[model samples]
Target: MSTCKNCQNQLTPDSDYCNKCGARVIRNRLTFGNLFTHFSEEFLNYDNKLLQTFIALFAKPEAVIRSYISGTRKKYVNVISYFAIAITIAGIQLFILQRFFPEAMSMDSISTEATKEFNLKILEFIQDYQSIAMMLNVPIYALVSKLVFIGEKKFKYNYTEHLVIYMYLLAQLSAIGTVIIVTAAAFDLSLGTTSLILSPIQFIYIGYALKRIFNLDWTNFIMRTLIFICALIAFTVIASIVTGVLMYFNGDFQKMIEAQKAANEAARTVKDTIN
Candidate 1:
């Protein structure tokens, strides 16, 4: 037994605080090393949690997100915070690649001018609305997942609960996508090849995530995964239709296509003049 340093109350030697007065008892002297030690301990768990977050997020996302939604969130990052951080990371990846690797993004890497133009349009759309597009997909994804898994006998996660899963999934994808882009840039990989490599990684991540989350048998897992993917495709089609309608009514879609055509024609004319 020992005495409290602040209140002189009796306490155990290992006690961190005085029980009587509730004063801290294990304080260390303030110095550069101690300051950094304390700062790092609080900084990592309370605020700067991306590293520990990705550890669970990539390795066992279902478990982590489930724990979070279940209200035990001391160890896992908040879902919305993770999603926002992931978006920022993806944006940074685009910024770095655009600023540093111009040749990798040039039309020379693609097979044809038409393909290049298509990719350019897609990229432009993504750059303009990727964040909003991704956010909107979350609820649509949750709805699809719920409908697909509505027949599960063992466990049935509710619609709201599925949002937790989808949010974590998107966060993981954004983080992994950022890494993929950075790697592709480093290796001078073309966008087509990058997508080819990334698609499988994305599928595998979600596959294992579902596997762990639902504890499904192989047959059910395969069935659910396929349906989930199809649901995502359906959601994409619906979103595209909605986007097209909005653009059409506002004259943006036609203007965008016309602008693209004009640019392509101008490039051809310049090439012909040079030749």
Candidate 2:
């Protein structure tokens, strides 16, 4: 009797596969040549899949999401793995900026005391918790998506499906955002001004992606896109306020405000003496 190497199942000499485990009956031994060849093949295959995913994500995000939902698995990385890796890359970028590009962003130059305090508190909160903040966005995106994009058949994406879509979308966006941050730091660009300049690009990318995903015509597309944008703005404002309030009660925000106010008063006293 011949045996299957994979499961050690008894088989006829003529059998091409193991009956018990459905394993392919391979004849080749584990040679160094085969090991190298297999390693290269797997590595290249993974690299290719990653590239295809990013291309589809940037060039036609809706199509990639749709394809994944339709059971196509080979062309892209799984959403969970993609999101984890993307967030880690983003965290690296944030660390680099915070450590090496300290002067890239500062509210210290602003004159208004309240504005300075509020902005500094917010900035510190964001800097400290940006990774967690972005991760928190996944569920919010899924929620908003299900709310805004409800329809039948081709237009309908269920909540879990929408979660998958958002995971991929957010991963790609996080990578893009990290790149934008690095570029701004390199050029000594104002993050506020850069955000303003990039807002339309963000809207356009999202609008086109959603339009394709929803299969909407121009009028409905514009209406739905605007509504989604408004929803996002509202959600962001609420989240920011909640974060600020929590930090305030914890005494973190109070410390920032007091420090800023003391600095401002000292500056005022110095100016008065000079006058």
lDDT of 2 by residue, 129-155 (tens): 877877778889888878888753566
Q: Return the TM-score for each candidate structure.
A: 0.72, 0.75
lDDT of 1 by residue, 1-275 (tens): 77887888999868888889998786577799977877788555545566677887777776687788789887777888888877887778778877887555543454364445445656677768878867876898789889988997666788988898988897888788878777887898866667777888988887898788888889988988999898889888887688778877988777767877987899999999999
> TM-score of predicted model 2?
0.75
At residue 78, candidate 2 shows an lDDT of 76
Error of 2 at 155 (Å): 1.6
Note the residue pairs that clash in candidate 1. Answer: none
Clashing pairs in 2: none
Worst 10 residues of 2 by lDDT: 105-114
